[model samples]
Target: MIKIAVVGCGQIAQRWLRVLTAHPKVSVTALVDTDLAAARRLHALGQVDAVTATTVHQALALANVEAIVNLTPPAAEPEMTRLGLTLGLHVLAEKPLTVRAAPAQALIAHAEQVGRRLMVMRNRAFDPGYSAFVRSVAGRGPLLAAGETFVQLRAPGFRTAHTALADLGVHAIEQARRLTDAPVIAVRCTEHPAAHLAPHAGLVTLLLEFADETVVSWRGGYAGPGLRTPANGRWSADTATGSATFDGQRQLRVGDEMVELEPAAPGYELCIGDMLAVLTGGSITPASVSATDHATSISVLEAATLSLSTGDRIQLAGTR
Candidate 1:
């Protein structure tokens, strides 16, 4: 069994704990959080038998851990991942990898130097419905894609209008990248203020152009009330032959046919299972997003952020 330390004891961390504890190959050896009480509270739930610590260094001293499940916020991801790799532990981290592409690339290089796996969780890719949608569109030529995600969200204290694209739009951006067979060549974005929500929250619209001529338009926000969409949002793609659409739920429409998708295990469970398999010597598949892909996605987001500020289409230097 792989002994693992779970870093960050927030809501997402709790969800991951439930999945990790149930996995036969995993042993939850420690829980780490800045707030030791929060880590203790998670331990008190009785689902996991583990020690609690305020930092990864403390957790290492307290337990014999082989890997780290990094659940920290985006800003903390780079440091935590680097520390884990430096300490000779594999790291499975949450998304955005980092707000900038350079730092993410640097971390990937560090992980290589240490000969440890450094993976970012792309849970959405493992979702059965989204997976089906991707399979249905495979081999289709350069396409036109569009997606919209509108949900009423209570803005967290750490969120702001400027950060909305990185937080909510990354999924949609990555999804678009998955659907297309080309590199994202340019990105343009616009942000709008939402008066009804918290002062820091608002709406974002993004336009991505791919090297193969595929173009994707995506809009997402935390301010829409009745306009709320499912967590994955509504998505559609069109090629010369036909069009396909995903309601972001159990139904996928491909041309004249309807494919019913059955609900599967939570994405976190599936994602962790894949990671375990790879760690146990199984080969990696295209379905698993590589560190290179993660860096490319971060580059796209970084371009989008620049677009938001400059009001011009930002061109990527090259695809990572």
Candidate 2:
């Protein structure tokens, strides 16, 4: 069993605790939050019976863990992951590796320089719901075009300007890559500020043109004025042979057949399993999200943010 320290006992941390504590190969050795009260609340609620600390430094001292499950807010993720990587522990971080592309890319480079395993959690690819869809695409050839959407009544931490594209849209970008296996060549974005709130871009529509000539359009809502009615959710990817559609639930349809998926382990569980598999002699697959791809997702979002701010499509560097 790999001893793991979970950082940030907030909303995401709750999920981590539930999944990691029960896993046979994982040990939730420590929990940390900036607010001791919040950390204590999760500790008591979970009945984890483990060491708890209010900071990463303190947690590291107390727990002899081999990995860090970082569920901290987007801004804190890079530093937290860096601390663990610096200490030679593998890190599985939540989406949007950092607030910007450059920092995220820097972390990836640092991880490589130090020879550590770094993975960003993109569970949609591992979701059992899409297994048949994955199989369908095997015979169909390269993904031609794709779309991924996530509409929520409110997006967490998106109350600030230019945050919606980064906070929520990043996941969609990852989804597009997972299905399409292409890099974003160009991006066009349109965003609207939240109603009755500070000039935060609460809603965003992104057009990502991929290297495989597959264009994935994605969009979502944040804590804005108000969410649009019937203004939520959709994903469809087409190859020359066939197309697949996600019902935004667990259902996906390819051509005329439907593949229903029973709920598998929670995303965190699958993600931790993926990390441990690699750490314990599991090889990385072509389908897996790599450090480079993770960084590119942030870059695409950064381009979208720039596109929205400039009211002009941004052509990503080094793509045709």
Candidate 3:
């Protein structure tokens, strides 16, 4: 069995725990969090003989875990991943991997040199609801235009700078890239923090230009006025042949075929499952995570943030 440690006890950690505890070849050997109580709470529910520590260092010092599933926040991901790799542990990190692209790119190279598996959770690609959309886009010539919107209540931890763009916009960028054989090359963005209305960093409006001459407009934030659906998010894409729209509930309409998929495992569950399958000598048909692709997505968001400051379009330097 692959002994593993989960190094965060936040909203996402609980979801990962649900999937890990059920996997036969994986053992939940350690749980870590800055908040020991939260770690203890997770450990109590895991029903595994696990060590609970207040930090990754303490957990590694005490437990014989072979892998670490990093569920820490974006700001802490680079440091946590480096520490895990230094100890010769395979790492599966939750995305938006890090705030800065350079550190993230460096981590990818370091993991390759260390010969440890470093996988980012690019959950959208694993979702089945997008299958029809993928087919439709494949049949079409190329992606011409796209739009995606994300909104949620002002949750705790949304107050940090560019947190929303990094957290959710990463997914938007990934999904946008997924629609066609195109690379996003440039970005122009404008942010509306709307601080007087909320304590969090609010809405961000972005225009992404792609190598295939596709352009996608993106909007995402904690709490925003007048831009929301019955669902948490929604996306629409158009090509030469047909169009597609995903209603955030794992349902999509591709070229008039109204399709509502069954409640598939949440992307988080599927992503963690993929990571475990790889560890156990099983494989996902096409790998779900790529560090280079993630770097492009992160760099796009970085450009967006910089655009917020300078009020200009930012060009991405060679993502290939």
Candidate 4:
């Protein structure tokens, strides 16, 4: 079995633990977190018997671990990812890769240099909602137009005046890119503040023009004001063909057609499985990285954030 180590025992880390524990091909043999208590909690959740560490180096020294699952915040992501890659261990990191596109690209470069796999955890693609989306466009050819909305309810850390597009828009943008395989050539964004902790309750009316002549419109908010019906949930994708809609959330639509799915695997589980497969000398495929897509998707979100703040259209530079 492939042995794994989890770094950063946050909410996403817990999700990774749950999914990793369920996969028969992998075993989470170690845990690491800045907070020992949090790491203990994750250890308990996974029912793991391995010792927990307070740092990446400590975890790596354990000699039983083959990969690291990084669930840390964006601020700490690059450094942690660097550690894993330098140690020749595969990494499955939380989304947005880093706070911006530049550093994220650097991380990818380092991984390539070291021949270590770096997979971003973009589990939304594996979501049932996204599954429905893929089926809608599988054989239809290049898409003409697409749109997405990311809505979530009020919770602590829900709203901020100056928001990081990497946190919210990355999901929508990446999912769109994966679905369309088209690069976002241009971007424009706007945000609105509210009474919440952040000035803006939510954002509205964003646009991304793809190279394939596909225009993507996106809107998202957390308890955003002026909008009827507060949509408190994770990001979701949708697509349509002559009013026959395929929603990432609802799965089957209009008479239960079988939407082709790569599989129903969870993100962390898929990440771990792919890492182990690589250890056995296998190649990585889209299905393996279905939960992960780095580079260009992150650039779109970063560019959008820059646009939202400066009131200028930001073009993604050096996109892969």
Best by lDDT: 1
**C-alpha-based local distance difference test score of model 4:** 0.64
Better of 2 and 3 by TM-score: 3
lDDT of 3 at 269: 69
lDDT of 3 by residue, 106-198 (tens): 898988889888888888755566544566567466566555565655565524645667766777777766766666778887766656656
lDDT of all predictions, in order shown?
0.83, 0.70, 0.75, 0.64
Tell me each candidate's TM-score: 0.94, 0.84, 0.90, 0.80
Model 4: weakest 10-residue lDDT segment is 228-237
Better of 1 and 3 by TM-score: 1
Q: What is residue 63's positional error in candidate 4, in angstroms? A: 4.9
Per candidate, the number of residue pairs that clash is: 0, 1, 0, 11
What's the C-alpha lDDT at position 40 in model 4?
Answer: 92
Cα lDDT tens digits, model 2, 117-205, are 78877666555554445556654555654454434444344246656677667766666656655567888998776665444536678
RMSD of 4: 4.3
TM-score between candidate 1 and the true structure: 0.94
Error of 4 at 218 (Å): 0.8
The reply for model 4, stretches above 4 Å from the true place, is 126-128, 138-161, 197-201, 224-241, 251-281, 287-293, 316-320
RMSD of 2: 3.5
